[model samples]
Target: MRLRKVMLVFKKDWLEIKRNHEVILPMIIIPLILSIGFPLVFIVGITMVPESASSMEDLENMIRNLPEHERNALSQMTPLQASIYLFTLYFLAPLFLIIPVMVSSVIAADSFAGEKERKTIEALLATPISDSELLLGKVMVSFVPSFMITVISFIAYSILVNILSFTMLGRFLFPNLLWIMLIFCLSPAMAFASICLTVIISAKVKGFREAQQISGMLLLPIIALMLGQIAGIIMLGPVIIGVLTLSIILIDYAVLSLSVRAFKREEILQKLI
Candidate 1:
């Protein structure tokens, strides 16, 4: 693919995103709430609650079930400290995956589907861009922004978590290897997968709402992972992280290959008719 053509499409899509509040608003607002708002509330609430003996005991029992090294780390802290550590560090990890999934799906949902809404698909299809060039450009629109937002959100979350826990723990406890892997590896893979799925849906769906609704189904896995972690059934270790990243990468390749074939200019023009 020609870099010039891909950049041109990227630039055009970026400009359109800026003008279309429907597409851009949720992209920014959702991440802000997840990354900053929820953490702020959790940190503040934990700081205010006084440590009780019963609560401490329950927390201790839960931590004891964790792996040896993990249990040892939390065992050193007071009950309140342990509770905060559990929620901010461990519980929030899986839930963080939702950021990239949601952001990419939102943008990709708007791609061809939104163009259809605006009656612009024919003009877009008439352009001289090759099929691969077009697909790559559209994929990047969602993939790039979603990955960047995930990184930024992770940074914001890590800073907030450490700052809030520092008073109790007396040290920075975030950006650990697990978190680093999640952000740099697993998170981008998740975003890419979402982009490919949503792009495929957008090509066939007639409206942005329909495309978005279908793409939203991708969240089911992330939600399941979050629930599993809460129930102590799943853990985010290096091995699990590696497996998830590989799975997502394979799915992304498969979905993207199919999406490119399905994104035929003639099919899009026919839909526009």
Candidate 2:
């Protein structure tokens, strides 16, 4: 019964989403700018900036710019040293992860409030599914696609980052193990966290626009994280990043629980008028 109900709701929601250009356009545009266009543009700009045979123009002017023969010899350096270089390269890809998580959050935040705005909540509440089932179905609908898109975007961004960095630096510089952990592992947790939290916000808000504005406020931390990464203030190693991912995942679970508990059909119906 629960499975059928969930699928039924999912199908309905999917159809509705397909008809919403505001939702679809943002989902596509955010990744296009952050994952593909920005990285490609940045790489082109980086390559165009004339670097001497041995000078990197980043990080207090600290990018490795050794002679070609000298750089080839550094290949035999300690693993720790190599990891540091990889981490630096990985910094270029943070926008890819950050944008998708944020975009997902915004979408999730809109789901409930959007229904309220459209005056469709009363009908949704009148559906036979229990409140918990309905909430879970909505969550699954919002989260699953956002998470999948984020994963795919990361893969595409990694490929773009790699190709660009190699073309410019003559070596595959981005997407080290730390980045892999951050992008693939931590990113989904953060995405789900954002989605669940924003959905909770949506349920309480009056209109989709209001919910989106409020939800967008949550992105400040994400922006700060990206800026910090760019400024080289916070380096997320595998151990530290693993802890971060676990923390966000735990937060997501907690929010999911709260969303279900607080998601009363009565409230939705009460707000319908």
Measured by lDDT, the strongest candidate is: 1
Model 1: pairs clashing at backbone N, Cα or C within 3 Å: none
Worst 10-residue lDDT window, candidate 2: 52-61
Across 1-273, the per-residue lDDT of candidate 2 in tens digits comes to 387787777778878887889888888888778777875665455445534122222432222422354346446543333333433354544665577666676567667898888887878888789877777777777777777777777778767756754654567755577677877788777777777777777888788887778878777777787677656666555776789888888888887788778777777656655
The lDDT values for all models are 0.83, 0.68
List candidate 1 segments past 4 Å from native: 51-65
C-alpha lDDT of residue 144 in model 2:
71
Assess candidate 2 and give its TM-score to the true structure: 0.82
Q: For candidate 1, write residues 88-146 as lDDT tens digits.
A: 87778876789988988888998889889988888888889997888888889888888
**Residue 7 of model 1: what lDDT?**
82
